[model samples]
Target: MSEEDYRIGLIHATVNSVQPILDAFQVHAPQVTLVNFMDESLIFELNETGTVTKNMARRLLNLVEKAVMSGVDGVLLTCSSFTPVVSEISHLFDVPMLSADVSMLEKAVDMGTRIGVIATVEAAGPTTTALLEKIASKRQKDVTFKTVIIPDAFKALQNGDRTKHDKLIHQKVQELANDCDVILFAQFSMARALETLDMTTTPPILTSPEISVKSIVAKISKKEIVI
Candidate 1:
């Protein structure tokens, strides 16, 4: 299929994540069409419960099912907190399905033994760390993780305080620079924080949207739906 013919579905848990991935695609693969499915309630419920409930998983599956039924070539789940659920339900779909952070985490694992994960959501930090460990274990590599959760930053972003949100993440990135081999921002929304940091001065800090977009684009280009 031609690049324009490929349709990738982006499943988001919050409005915060939508734009970053869209920006990434605009920069990296503008020819591919994107279809978005968002459920803001998922994030609210997750924040309240502090975990993924069975109902949440079912909702996520239904969303992906709807995306597939719409004829997307692949599905990208944009929330790190719900990433683990992708592993459980991906086999049910023929198209490739991916959690946004998986590509980033795999790259982090390959780059260093000590990985630092920063997130603005309570659940995202642990979810990212667990996924990192899983990636390392699958590769038979021993890895250590340091996770920092700044719920306040998430609140700040939600309230339209982008300056404060970026500042908080920038501070953590600086703190983790010397301590870790690499730093990873756990949410697609946090990608904006990179603009405020001096990349040359920090450890290889990574974000999900760009890497995930490139991964999905490559897969779709090759017509390979391996997840």
Candidate 2:
């Protein structure tokens, strides 16, 4: 690949919380280009209605494929709960496609036997719990995963109510602090909430950015050739 060919496509639910992750990536791989395709409001809707419309999925796929066609070295999906569709897309592209939460999952598995999944979006809770369970079972260790949702935070973010969103997330995470060994932010957007909450009273809080940044950097250093 040419020096100018390093590019990545980020498919995100919202652009708000993704800035730090991208900034970290920029420092590690300055040559890499980022193509951001954001819905900005879908996560909130999914939280409110408990559904992701087919049309929304279609729109996301279209933009994702566009990024692939635009010559991205790899794709990093930023929405944790949407990995079902991301898995299909990765198969279709037959390239490097990393899930947003793979890093956090790996860390949680290595850290302790009990994991807590905290997602501000209601629809994400059950789905994220299953992911943690699957990862734990693969390691031949029976682990327990507890999921808790912050009521209405997603909706509040959608409505531009940052204070309400932050408060609810802080409260819910604190409530779940006593139950698990490690806290995994199930949604990429929840990173901020994790920071807002008091970490002194809880287990270690893990975010996708730390893991994804490392994962992407490794991929870059290995310099895998796709074509």
Candidate 3:
């Protein structure tokens, strides 16, 4: 791809879930370009309590604002729990700013009301559950969210234990199959776990990559020419 072919800028706090999304995005939309960067401080803040802090949002905004200022066509944040800041950033920027969670949650709601949100971080599970419930109410769909936090899954990923992380996530998703109407992966970095695990027993699973990229593509195409 040439410099002129690349156009979209993706802002991520971490790279875990961004890998597969990039692969899929390239295959799904070959003409668009994606750029990723990390705010090292947000990783520490998220891991400290498995949640975002005031400082984390500040650091994230600094990176995302710069991406917008650089003349990118659109911005998609890969972090799920940072929706508060994501909402604020989307409004502040002229270009489309999207949340990885909101895009995927819309898809999940369309599938069913009894949804299971699985996340690597402790906070992501509840945060996503709340967001889905809100979306469901706004759409007037009767919905309930079942949240499961995969214990040690984030630690395994953080510790570089890919195999263990995959195993734990698979087990958690499997257990949820008995309860939820659909399974939704909450963290962006956990996308690899979906391909690694056998989700035959669980309901349909939704990830951030395709949903978010597609939404941003639609939002940008109307406002600017695609490279």
Candidate 4:
């Protein structure tokens, strides 16, 4: 299919995560028209509230509804912390929908039993950890999961210091490298740190952007008219 034929709706909880996903699309699906839906405040609110409340969930659904109504070929919920809502209300949309962390989680389980998840946002920790466990269970893979949040990292990115954010995540992933069979970067934005790592020494690092983009493309190609 020509890249021009694919239209994607990228739903994001933070603007910081958008560029990484876009960069992935450029390399993997450049012909696709990428329409982005972002709310930088959503992550702050979720962090403040400690969970996705009923109202917050409604907001997420409304966002996806907007994307569906916009006639996207597929929707990628690039925010790991918000995937549960997308997963829950997926039936509402006739189009294909995906959680950013899911494809990576499936790959992680297939790669090894002990998975280490590194997330920058506290709220994302529980959401991603649960996702990894769920996928592992369904695959009948005996997986042991551990999540470590770079408490200061997401805030740094939100505050406009990308260097600090990436440095903290890269450091933490390296610290956890020897402890687990494989290290998974929990949030979609963390894929940025992959370029800085030495894969020869660290455990295999799994990220969401490229893999998630591939999943969306495959689903849309099969269904032919998710929008």
Top candidate, metric lDDT: 1
- In model 3, the worst 10-residue window by lDDT is 1-10
Candidate 1 Cα deviation (angstroms), residue 149: 0.3
Off by over 4 Å in 3: 1-6, 49-51, 225-227
lDDT by residue (27-48, candidate 1, tens digit) is 9989889999989999999999
lDDT tens digits, residues 1-227, model 4? 55478888998888878989999999998989988887767888988988999888888888888898898878999989988887689898888899887888888999998899998888889888888888877877788987899879887877888788889988887788878999988887788878766678788888899999899998888786443
Local accuracy of candidate 3 as per-residue lDDT tens digits, 1-227? 33345477777777675686687687677678777767755765776776677777778888887887777877887788787678765677787778877878988998987898888887787789888988898899998787888859878887889999989988888888988888888977888887787765678888887777778777676566544
Q: How much lDDT does each candidate structure score?
A: 0.92, 0.74, 0.78, 0.86
**Every model's TM-score:** 0.96, 0.85, 0.91, 0.94
Best candidate according to TM-score:
1
lDDT of 1: 0.92
What are the per-residue Cα lDDT tens digits for candidate 2 across 201-226? 88888888768866865665465643
Could you tell me the lDDT of residue 105 within candidate 3? Answer: 93
Task: Name every residue pair that clashes in candidate 4.
Answer: 3-31
Clash count in backbone of candidate 1:
0
| Model 3 steric clash total | 3
Error of 3 at 225 (Å): 9.0
Better candidate by lDDT, 2 or 3: 3
Per-residue error at 215 for model 2, in Å? 1.3
Which of the two candidates, 2 or 4, achieves a greater lDDT against the reference? 4
TM-score of 1: 0.96
Ten contiguous residues with the weakest lDDT in model 4 = 218-227
> Looking at model 2, which ten-residue stretch has the lowest summed lDDT?
218-227
